[model samples]
Target chain A: ATTRIFGQARFTCLILFYVLFYGTYLVSGALVFSALEAPIENQIRLDLIRAKQDFLVRHPDVLDDDLESLLDEVVRASNHGVSASRNVTGGPNWSFGQSLFFSSTVVTTIGYGHVTPLSQPGKLFCMIYALLGIPLTLVLLSALVERLLLPATALLRSLNAALGHLYRPFTIRLVHLTIIVTTFLVFFLVVPAGIFAYLEPEWDFLDSFYYCFISLTTVGLGDYIPGDSPGQPYRPFYKIATIFYLITGLTFLMLTLTVFYDIPQLNLSSVFSSIKLDED
Target chain B: ATTRIFGQARFTCLILFYVLFYGTYLVSGALVFSALEAPIENQIRLDLIRAKQDFLVRHPDVLDDDLESLLDEVVRASNHGVSASRNVTGGPNWSFGQSLFFSSTVVTTIGYGHVTPLSQPGKLFCMIYALLGIPLTLVLLSALVERLLLPATALLRSLNAALGHLYRPFTIRLVHLTIIVTTFLVFFLVVPAGIFAYLEPEWDFLDSFYYCFISLTTVGLGDYIPGDSPGQPYRPFYKIATIFYLITGLTFLMLTLTVFYDIPQLNLSSVFSSIKLDED
Candidate 1:
C-alpha cells in the first residue's frame, strides 16, 4: 500500500514534469518561430501589397475591385495547386502521377498536401481511403521493421561480445544507437537531400535537407514537393522513385525506433510503467 | 525443423500478400482520386486562365508579361499564407497564436503547411524543435493515455462482470470497444465538427468533418484550417481552443488504440510474433 502510494505520487510528479517540459518547449518554439518567420512574412506581405499598388499605377484603367477579384482567383487556384502562370506546362494536379503521389502521402501520413482533393466526392473518398490505408501502412511498416531488426540485433550482439569487458551495457547500447542513427541519417537524409537538391532547380542543399527531414518525420509541411516544379521531365518516374524513397526511409526510421526501445535504460516509458500505481 | 520451415514459408507469404495488397490499394486510390479530381482541377485551371485573359482584355494597356509576373508574385505570397487582398486585416501568420498552432502541429506531425517558416534559420530551428518535441509529445500522450486507460479498463471489467454468464469474453470486449468508439466519434469528430461548421462561415458539415478527420489522423493535408477566415473575432482564443481539441482528441485516440490492442484475438502483431521464426 505504501509503495503504491509512493508510486502514485511519483507518477503525478513525472506527469507534471513532462507537462511543464512540453509546455516550455511549445512556448519556446512558438516564440522562436514567431520571431524568425514574422519579419519575413511581413516583408513578403508588404512586397506583394506594393506590387499590387504598382500594377494599379501602371494600368490606371484596371479597377481596384476587379484586380482584387482576379488576384483572389489566382490565389485560390494556386492554393489548389493549380498554377496560373502560362509557363507552367505540367499536367493538371490530379493527373495519374500526382494522384499516385497524393495517395502514397495519404497512406503513409506524410500528407505533403500540395494537391488535396477539391471535390466533395473526392474528400469523402479520401477520408474512407485513409481510414483503411493508414492501418495497412502501419502494419506493413511494422512488419518490415521487424525484419530489419535481425541484422541490427546481430550487430549489437557482436559488439556486446567484443566489448564485454571494456564498457558498460548502456555505453555499448548508446554506441549501437549512434551507429544506426548515423547510417539512417546518411542514407535517408544526407544522400537523399543531395539527390533532391541536384534534381530540384529552386531547392538548395538546405531546402532539400529540410524536405527530407520534414518528410521522413511525417511533418510534410508541403512547402517544397519534389516534382512539382513547372515542367519536370519524367514526372511519373520521379514521383514513383520518391514514393519508394519515402517508404524505405520510413522503415529505417521505425527500425531505429525499435532498436532504441530495446535498450531498457533508454526506454523512459518502461521506467514509468514499472511504477505500481493504484488504478483509482 | 518442419515447424520452422513452415513458419518461414508463412512469413514469406504474409509479406508477399501484404505487399500485393498495399500495391493494389495504392493503384486503386490513384485511379479513384484521379477520376474524381481531374475534371474539377482542369475546370479550375481553365477558369483561372479565362479570368486572366478577361482581365488582360479589360486593361488593354497592361502587358501580359507584367500581369503574369504580378500574378506569380501574388501566388508566391499566397502560398506563404499572405493574402494580396487589401481587405485582409488579420495580423501576420506568425502571431503568437498561429505560431502556437504551428508548433503544436509540428510536434504532433500534423504540419498543416498552410503557414510554414520561410527563413533558413526558421527551417533549421523547426527541425531541431521537432526532433525534441515529437518524442516529448509521444511520451506525454502515452502518459495521459496510460492515465485514461484506468477508467477504460474499469469499464471493460464491469462489462465483463455484467455479461460474463451470457456472452464470451470476445463479445464483451467487442461491446466495450464499440461503446468507446462511439463516444470518441461523438465527442471528438461529430461534436467538434459541428462546432467548426457553425463557427467557420465557409465550412459546411462535410468540410468541417474532413478537417477534423484529416487533422486527427495527422495526415493534415491542411486544405482547411480553423480561425483563418478574414476578420474573424477572437482568433487567438479560437486557435488555442483548437490546440486543446487536437491534443485531447489525440489522447482519446491513443486510449482507443490501447484498448484495442488489449484484446488477444484482435492483436495480429502478437500472433505474428508468436510464430517465432529463427533469428538468422
Candidate 2:
C-alpha cells in the first residue's frame, strides 16, 4: 500500500511536470513570436498606410476619409491572400504539378492551405485525394520508419555493450536517444532551414526554421510557403523537391519518435497507462 | 514460395482497394463542398468587384486607369483576409481566450492558420508550445481512446456472442465496426455539424459538415472558422467550446481508428509488416 501510494504520488508529479514544461514552452514561444512579428506587422501596417496616403496624394480630388477607409479594406484583403491579381497572374493553383504537390501536402496532413482549391471540382478532388492519400502516406511512412528502427535499435544495443560497465542501461539509452535526436535536428531542421533561408528571398533563418518546425509537426499554418515568390525559377521543380523534402523529413520525424518511444522510461504512453492501472 | 507470392498479391489487392475506397470518399466530399462553396465564393467576388466599381463611380475624379487598378489591388487584398479594418476591430488575436484556442488547435495539429502568431515572441512561443503541446495532446487523446476501446471491444464481443451461430466472426466484426463508425459519424460529425451550422451565419449544413470532416481529420485548411462573425455573443466562451469540441471530436476519431485497426484483416500495418518479412 505504501509503494502504491508512492507510485500514485510519482504519477501525479509526472503529470504536473508535463503540464508545467509544456506551459512554459508555449508561453516562451508566444513571447518570442510576439517580439519578432509585432515589429514586422507594425512595419507592414505603416507601409500600407503610407501607400494609401501616396495614392491619395496622387489623386487629390478623391482624398476623402471614406476613400482612405476603402483603401485600408483593400490592403487588408490583399494581406489575407485574397488578391484578384493572385488569381490572374499567380496561375492556376491546381495545375497538374501544383495539384500533385498539393495532394502530397494534404495526404501528409501538412495542409499549408496557402494555395487551396478554388473551384468545386478542385475542392472535391482535394477531399478525395486526402482521404486516400493520408492513409497511404501513413502506411508508407510507418513502413519506412519500421525499417529504419532496425539500425536505430542496433545502435542502441551497441551503445549498451559499449557502456555496460560504465553506465546504467537507461543512461546509455538516453545517450543514444540524444545522438539520434541531434542527428535529426541537424540533418532535417538545421540544414533544410539554411537551404530554405537561402532560397526564399524574403525569409531569414528564423522564418525558415519556424517553417521547418511547423511543417514537420504537421501544424502547417501556411504562413510561409516556398516558391510562391514572383519570378521564382523552376517553380514546379522547387515545389516537387519541397514535397520530397517534406516526405523524407516526416519519415525521419517518425523514426525519431519511434526511438523516443523505445526508451520506455521517457514514454508518456507507458507512464500514463501505468497510472491508469494504478487507478484501477 | 507460392504462398508467399499469393500473400504479396493479396497485399497489393488490399492496397488497391484501400486507395479506391478513400479516393471515392474524398471525391464525393470534394464534389459536395465544391458545389456548396463555389457559388458563395463567386458571389463574394462579384460583390467585391461591384463594390469597387461603385466606389470609383461615386468618386468620378478617381476614375483614371491607375486609380481603377489601385482599387482592384485593394479589393484583392481584402479578399485574402488582410483588411486593416479586421486588425483594428477584431482586437488582438493573441488574447487569453483566443490564445488558448489557438494553442489547442496547434497541439491537435488542426492548425487553421487563420489568426496566426504575428509577433516574434508569439511565433517563438507558438513553436515551443507546439513542441510540447503536440505530444501531450497525443498522449491525452491516445489515453482517452484506449479507455473508450474497452467498452468498444466489449460491445464487439457481445455482438460476436449474439451473432456467432448465425454469421461468421469476420462478418459480425464488420457489422460491429459499421455500427461504431456510424455512431461516431452521427454523434461527432453530424450533430456538431448541425450545431455549427446553426451558430455560424455563413455556413450551411454542408459547409459545417465539411468543416467537421476537415477538422476531425486534422487537415484544418482554415477556409472556415467559427466565432469570427461580427458581434458574436460570448465570443471567448464560444471559442473555448469549439476547442473542446475539436478535442473530443479528435478523440472519437482516434477511437474509430483504433477499432478499425483492431480488425486484423483490415490492418495495413500488419499486412505491410508481413510483406516486409516475406521480402526479407
**Candidate with best TM-score:** 1
TM-score of each: 0.95, 0.79
lDDT of 1 by residue, B1-280 (tens): 6775576667767777888989899999999999999999989988998999998898889999999999888878887888787666777899999999999999999999999999999999999999988988998898988777767888989998899999998999999999999999999999999999999989999999999999999999999999988889999999989998999999999898888888888886665456544422
Give the clashing pairs for model 1.
Answer: none
Compute DockQ for each candidate against the true complex. 0.80, 0.31
Off by over 4 Å in 2: A1-60, A63-90, A157-168, B1-82, B85-90
Model 1 stretches astray by more than 4 angstroms:
A1-14, A275-280, B1-10, B275-280
Q: First chain TM-score in every candidate?
A: 0.92, 0.78
Residues B1-280 of candidate 2: C-alpha lDDT, one tens digit per residue? 7775576566566555654664454444444444544454455456556667777787777755766566554553343233445334554455566566667779889898876765566667778878877987887777667666767878988998888999998899899999989998999989999999999987888778778888888988887788876677888889868977898889888888888888899998776688657654
True-vs-predicted CA distance for residue B93, candidate 1, Å? 0.2
Best by DockQ: 1
TM-score for candidate 2, residues paired by index: 0.79
Q: For candidate 2, what is the recovered fraction of reference interface contacts?
A: 0.31
